[model samples]
Target: MSVRQTPLTCHGHTRPVVHLAFSGITDKGYYVMSACKDGKPMLRYGDTGDWIGTFEGHKGAVWGVALNYDGTRAATGAADFSAKIWDARSGHEEHAFQHNHIVKSVAFNPQGNLLVTGSNEKIIRIFDLQRPDAEPAKMMGHESNLRHCEFYTENIIVSCSDDKTIRLWDVTSAQEIRKLEFPNIVSDIEVSTQNRLLTLTHGNTVAFWNLDNLSLIKEFEVPTQIHSASLKPDKSIFVCGGEDFKLYKYDFDTGIELEAFKGHFGPVHCVRFSPDAELYASGSEDGTLRLWQTTVGKNYGLWKCVQAPSDLDKPGDAEG
Candidate 1:
């Protein structure tokens, strides 16, 4: 018989959790940041789901959140028409980049020296952290509201929109590099620098692309309308959640469904794998975030095993 895997549920946000991001492993362990409709963004311990602090200056719903590579800083995009950077350790607002319209997405480059934002105005802007007061470089082309944006490299950016397209831009030249058209609005996108893969979900399909060449590698048709999906660090498997209020896991190579379970009481908006890939976290319209293990029955982080008396007497039990 298979053991039922239970997830670690985190609750605090009074409104729907819209986005979730995990920082790379740092000296203090990695961290998880969440954006919510309550106008507050939160940072928490990644492994244990323990609340760390909340950044509280946004006057409107926070639509996007991101943590820098080392987890020292955080950035948030909000309905207040601004993107603010905060000290991850101190929880104090460092700087705010004002926008003409609501900002929908924010991301920090690998070096943490720059920030990229996408707004309702269908424009993308890059802010130089070293010179916060300097005018940001702007890139424009998207025909509709921007859904998500992120740094593809130090000099390249990728953005998706409600216009039913994904676009790439060159930061130095402020020019559009390439654009890919889709039949439906792209809901979520994940750029994996380590795996050299780009994962995208739109409608009921999930597509993977070669990060270097932007060529289609493969695509999978999911049973439900997925809002978000994430590839494991090794690219062996993936997980997604959607309007069905169920989390689904699949084998990456063959596109075979591995598991499907319902946990959230409402639609899930975002899902992301931890930097270590031991677990994946999901945020929902139910106003909660949940962390699920990638491998069931394995002792990892806050998830532990309770051995029975018979198992405790096994030959390898002591070593374990």
Candidate 2:
């Protein structure tokens, strides 16, 4: 077993990083992107945690950041009420998509041709990348904000909201397929397929559902309000982070705590697994990003990283 190590640190944003995503890369992976309430987005090298550059465009805080599978483009949602497309490497603005209200979440399809944006306006808009000027295929059902969305397949998209439900959407018809009810407002959601769903409860719980029957397979108990959760390809081992500023990993078969990661002094907002699932990353209110090594049944410690700085002063950027 390998012990987790803090090999590097970078610092820049003044606000806590609310979202983080890594491109689908295995060997010599290139970039990891982070979004903050400070109105800045950052891209860093995965292996070394080196600062690449800042994506300076949004006027208000950035709510979400998503990179395509190949990692060529990045889509950002902001409190500015818009979603913008940016060059993943150059940090150049490719397009500015206007929405009626603050954009809360954004996701890219598996093929990277479709971009989806959900907003407080109670609307989900799907845009075709090949045709930038085309009208978006819209899906409207939720009466409240669509908080987070996960594209399970080309035809299916799962979204969770403040309305306390998880909705499944059909991309071809741009209509809602089903609405799965939950006990609390959803904080985050991930899917391995249309049949499997992993939802982080608003409070301190994580639940896995088999959408085929809308039945709960496992209700993994957690200690803190989960800010985010990430799943493995096999859907056996997973992790969640919360206000306690700790990352907890569990084995799905037993629902027992496998390991706990401690580093962020502030609330952890986002967590993600690398494409190969050998590594995972977290973003936090500490204005920092952390990476961890994971194993199936064993405990791997924390490999937390905090980045370098920007010329502009922001909230979470302070070296904590």
Candidate 3:
């Protein structure tokens, strides 16, 4: 029998955590950024869940958060009708781009030169970070409010909405390239640039797609209604949580459930794998973030291994 590992629970949020993002591994290690309904966004050391600093200024609930590749910058979208960019190291707001309605999601392009945002106005906007004063390029199509958006590539962007469709757009042309309709509203999407796969969760289905061609790779029916799902960096397994207030892990290829444990007292809203795939983090309506090990009993970060008393030799038991 295997011993269940205790997850590291991170506290501080006063309300539900709506979104979470992990930065790429940096020289100082990676970082985790979180958005909460309390109108506060926070940054923490990714490995240890140590609170770093909170980005202040939003007057309404923060809905989305994103960290740049090198962990030097962060972006957030909020119900305050704005998306703001922050200097990750200083926790200072650099730019606040105002929107007509609530901004639901934000993403930084690979080069960190551009930012894209989705809003309740049913539009997607691309802002050039280099020229903060310039007007942003807009893309429109969805009849309902936007849920999430991200850059599929340097020249392409992908967005999902309450309209039950995911659309891909050419950034340069500002035109829709393709549309994927789902039977239910897509709640979450994970784009793995490293693995070239797109993971989407909707209704009771978790689907994987080929990022290059937008082809259907595989789809699995989950037992519970999941809001978010993230694939391991190596593509071996995935972890997800949702309405049932339980975290689940499953084999990626076999679609076999590996683990299902209840940790959060409330529903989980977001989950993502660490850059190293050492562990994954989940944000919940309980107003906390929990980190679980990919491989239990393995010593990584703050998770140290301990030997049982019977396994340890007596003081004088060993020969010199």
| Better-scoring candidate (lDDT), 1 or 3 | 1
For model 2, how many clashes? 13
Off by over 4 Å in 3: 306-320
- What tens-digit string does per-residue lDDT give for candidate 3 at 28-60? 999998899999998999988888899989999
Q: Of the candidates shown, which would achieve the greatest lDDT relative to the real structure?
A: 1
lDDT of 1 by residue, 1-320 (tens): 34555677888889999999999998889999989999999899998788889898999999999999899999999999999999999999999999999999999998999999999999999999999999999999999999999998899899999999999899999999999999999999999888888899999999999878889999999999999999998889999999999999999999999999887999999999999999899999998888888886577876765345334322211000
Model 2 lDDT tens row, 263-316: 787988988877767667888888888766675223322233323333122213
Cα lDDT listed for each candidate:
0.91, 0.79, 0.90
- Give the CA lDDT, 0 to 100, for residue 38 in model 3: 96
TM-score of 3: 0.95
Pairs clashing in candidate 1?
none
Which wins on lDDT, candidate 1 or candidate 2?
Answer: 1
Positional deviation of residue 269's Cα in model 2 after best superposition, in angstroms? 0.8
